[model samples]
Target chain A: MFKALSVREPQPACADVEALSETPVETLLELIDKAQQPPWVGMRAASCLIQGHADAVQDTLVDWVQQEDSRGFAILVLNQIDTLPQPVAIAVATQALAGPYASDATSRIAKSTNPALLALVP
Target chain B: MFRLPFALVALILLPGCELLTGLLNGGSGMLETRTSSVQSQDGIATIDVDVSGESAFQLTATSGQLLAVEAVNAPDGSQPLYWDDWSGVNSLTSAVWLEGKDTVLNWPVRQADGNLSDGTWTVDVAVVDDQGYYTDDQVDVVLKLKDDSDLSTGTVNARIVYADGLKQDSVVTAGVQDAVTRWAEIWAPYGINLETSYEDSSFSTDQPFPGEGSEQAEVSSGANGSEITVLITETIDGSTDYYGIAGGIPGTLDYTDHALVIVSWLTNAGGDGEFSDDDIRLFGETLAHEVGHYMGLFHPVETTFDYWDALDDTDDCGGQSACESALGDNLMFPYPVCDWTSCTPQDQLTSQQAGVNQRYTGTL
Candidate 1:
């Protein structure tokens, strides 16, 4: 169960502490650095789009999609998207997985067998 | 350190062309309320400004009306919150403000190169905080634009319900009500604002042993203060098809007293389809854009374009993959015959910047 946090930029975007993966708080700065690299390239930067649009965080990635990747998108598959400690984050993400890629052939991403997330976050 | 004169010249010149930040006109003219506060909700504020106050503020060039804007966010003084009105969008910046508003304390709009219409507008400062209802709480700011003989006008006061089409207040996220709120906000800059009563579109989504279907639901908002009333009718007998439309200017509805009706096919529900964020934003954009036509705005590039390409097409999330190139990349892109997402979030936001109540501009 490995979750990856992808941030294209630091400071206001990835920052420190914003990555609350249950126990510790570390800057996803490393995640940003890693996700933008190979093996992760073309591998949708999940938060690359969400992180850039999070409350208080400037939505630079949304524009990055237009100016950078016009057709394809960058996403990050995460073992966990719950740091907000609230279920709304999962609800929001569920709304995400429900749309766009809901029909993608990737059975893992589409069906979302892990109903555990819905119970945990909301 | 060495070239002090050059440094001063560069700094001075940059201030004049600061782009979206010019809302203040380098003075104290621009007053903005932040919608960055977030509450326990997923990520949307339920707010509605009383735009129908008895005391009207004449929108002169120098002194515009007073408006109280609201949004959903964390309470003030706790944490700095920043949110974009447009979510579910992939290409455009959902949040539009100056690069450093909290630091510099100046709110600006994010207008990239491709906004076809003139989108130099500012966020209204009514609510002053970010945490608001999913529907925006707005001030009743009355305005009168210049008299353009060609400018056709109408009002669209509505209460959008689900396919059953009855008035139900159960709230659904990223629902049709949210879509319409976004539309009205886009049309806010224009003279089209949604009525306060119907602002929050928390319609009922209840079901029953209910031999009823979601797809064949007749969802239409109640008509009140609007000259034009719009209703979204669904025709599926199963778990009905749904839609989101902001009734104000962003709905792109220009009629003063007619219902710019929107209908969705029965099969569009959770029935398998890869819905793109681009498509959602575009759907919100296009439906309103077409409604704008109902209000009397001509197509930006209707000469060689066709709106009929989407008559029965549902493949590209209501978008016609073929007509993107022929039409001028704008809200009114001329292809009205399909179901693909036609309008972009930027198009709606930019259109909201029109400011129809900003008094009759001699230049405009």
Candidate 2:
């Protein structure tokens, strides 16, 4: 049985932000799953994924949003996707807005400066 | 020789028309008036008005009111300010009365109704007889209000991380929620509300107490500029003496950022075990106290200076025993004791405390 430890400090992510960009998509997905272990680390991983592998990260986030157990974390990830490249970020945000996480996705998209992303808001 | 103004001489002589015959006949002699230099401190104005050859004098305000006497120079140790409650009035009229001649009447000026603001004001001093007759020889004194901004409102987001085993207990979750609710109610007047969430962790139960080694670094990691992160566990380094510990001094960056509370200690402090009413109350108060520090409130006597909480109304007990007796129920007191049936109301936040708390910039 895992001992219950309430850790207040942020855990060191599996990889640093710079190294996370070069890390493989599978590793990034695993880090996203680590959101259950320590939420902040997962948030940092998601940020790295959005900066590094936007397209793959977008697809993974959309899939996570589709799942019942992972939807909350996926919404948090989608919120961080604003830093992604315009076209890829727009596609991920559009899919998120069309899914169960539409409200959160719409809010994130509303903050974008890209016309296509802004147009998808309504 | 320089001559006095006719109007001034007339004012001195006429003395409210009724004294005309007395002055002409030299029946009661003449009234002499002298005012000292005015002094202002902490939004209060004080001055000394000396009157001789008059039975009594009345201090009237053109804008503000003559509040309580903060100090006096009288030899008899008599308080000059008198509070009079009139039958038909809703407010008490406070005034400075001079019973005899050659006494300096110290007057403190404060806001009256909505007339006082951040500017200079003039107060009128007139002679009054036993029959309510007022003299025309009125003197004007000036006062100024201090410039301090009003208090503001803020939001707190509290993240409660429980040990994995404790997180499974429904009682723990409910108790934590109740505690947060109580804290919100206590701070609602200050415009502070704790938005709380709980999480279960898989880390080891060997977490260090706050301010020891890496614990602070770890705990503060979850903290953001706008919210506080509270780590609740079964015990704090397995100590029962302390129910909760916060990081840093009040108004500092570290203090506003993180707090660690031990739920087990709070619950079992009186040997009643978990989920008891006393446990819930203690838990809430502990959280409130720690967060109070996060919001920049120091223990009334814990500061480097003597007996300072920066508020005038809250009592200051110089030492531990005195505090336990006189200020035992103060929320910011050093330690609190409780039992299963009832607990002390150590949860009250004074208005000045609330003002200091609301001045922090850590709101969402």
Candidate 3:
């Protein structure tokens, strides 16, 4: 008999940011590359990488935002990481607002309590 | 004076009495011996009996409620069953007046204890006159136990119809089955057992998201006839659309038993290098959510909003606007996250929801 789908493993990207910090950036990039492919392993990888190495992978994150397949995940990662430079964050937010993630990006921008980010909502 | 005459006639006719003498003396008002037998349909037993006399009669059951009562003489004359405060009045009592003729009374029986048992049951019918003189008669009824396993079980015929450009993968097929079966297990305690079957097929639509046309096409393909038909596609309209969209209430559509979930959303949602447990669970939760809609469930909202599922026990978010805070981790919450290792109480169906799910006619 086929085994039923079970949530046996530790929770995905959101659970342990500390554990994600140990994952290699190359592997994370590979995961992001296949984000549109089946099985959604890439999305989980992207979540971990973005959560753990958002500051270190800024250039790669920018590249992701330029592609149709990875833009949504890239925007989600950029919006979640607080440590990223304010200028880069604003640029990414601006791009997300203009792209398919406009509603989600707008909601995030409107909810941001940061003075600099709040000013960019409109 | 009447008593003295009746006693004198009974004494003289003790050895050889005519039927007229018995009727006049009220000694044998029972024209026929009380006999009863039960015939069950849809888990309820109907007790049929013939009682005849020239007096008023009361029928009482030992252990079950009379669901319905009907008089044979006036076929349309049926009374709702009600019970008196008698010690053994476990069921109902029907006080009927026979106009000096034979009448058949039908009593539909339902177990009061909620246990389906097979054995002999008894009913008592007593005939009484205006003067309070009465005679009692008893009848035995036999009921057979029914098979209860299939009471709430249903089937889901999952049809995985990928978009024109997408390739079919066995892993995705197995994962979809796993999700549906897991939902079945979650509902097992509430008497909902779901059996699922999977088929891999494709459609020519370039639109990633399925619209009404897609649903119509899927239904026309004869997917899961009368059972739930879930169409899993690679994408919906675009990669950015909703993860899934389910029809509201089972019978609302002409097809009546179909749902559409996006496998591409599942893939896009997971950034992991491979399918993880959380990924599978998220997929399962999405499927369960759509099926919940098909099962007549709505979002738990407490406001004047139109989308409220209308169940009381489910946490009622004030409205769509307050759903983010009030919805919490409820399974029927509009946008639930599946990042937990195990399901919470909020993630499972409330008792009322389980009942509704069991009562869904589409799955039946």
Identify the leading candidate in terms of lDDT. Answer: 2
- Can you write out model 1's per-residue Cα lDDT over B1-364, one digit (the tens) per residue? 0101110000001122221211111111221111122121222222211221111111101011111221212222121223332221211111122111110111111112111122122222222223221222322221222222211122344444343332331322243455566667666555544542333233332221111323212222243212233444332111121222222222111112212344331111111112234334444554466455433233332222222211111112223344444332445444322212222233422242232222111101
Please give the CA lDDT of all the candidate structures.
0.27, 0.44, 0.41
How large is the interface RMSD of each prediction? 18.2, 16.3, 10.5
Instruction: Score residue A74 of candidate 2 by CA lDDT.
Output: 53
Order by DockQ, highest first: 3, 2, 1
Interface RMSD of 3: 10.5
Which stretches of model 3 miss by more than 4 angstroms?
A1-122, B1-167, B204-211, B214-220, B251-269, B302-307, B317-327, B337-346
The DockQ value obtained for model 1 is 0.01
**Model 2 chain B worst lDDT window (10 residues):** B2-11
The superposed Cα distance between candidate 2 and the true structure at residue A22, in angstroms, equals 70
lDDT string, candidate 3, B1-364, tens digits: 0110011000001122221111111111121112233333332233432222111111222222222222222122333232222112111211222111121122221122122122222222223233433322222232111122233444333444544423354445566666666666666666665655555455542233323454544543454323455666544443322456554332121232223434443443443212446556656666666666655565554223333543556554454446645664556665442222323333566766665554443333
Kindly list the per-residue Cα lDDT of model 2 for residues B237-342, writing each as its tens digit.
Answer: 4322234665422322222122343333322222212345655665677788877765556666542214345456567556545655666667776555233124
Please state how well chain A of candidate 2 matches the true chain A, as a TM-score: 0.67
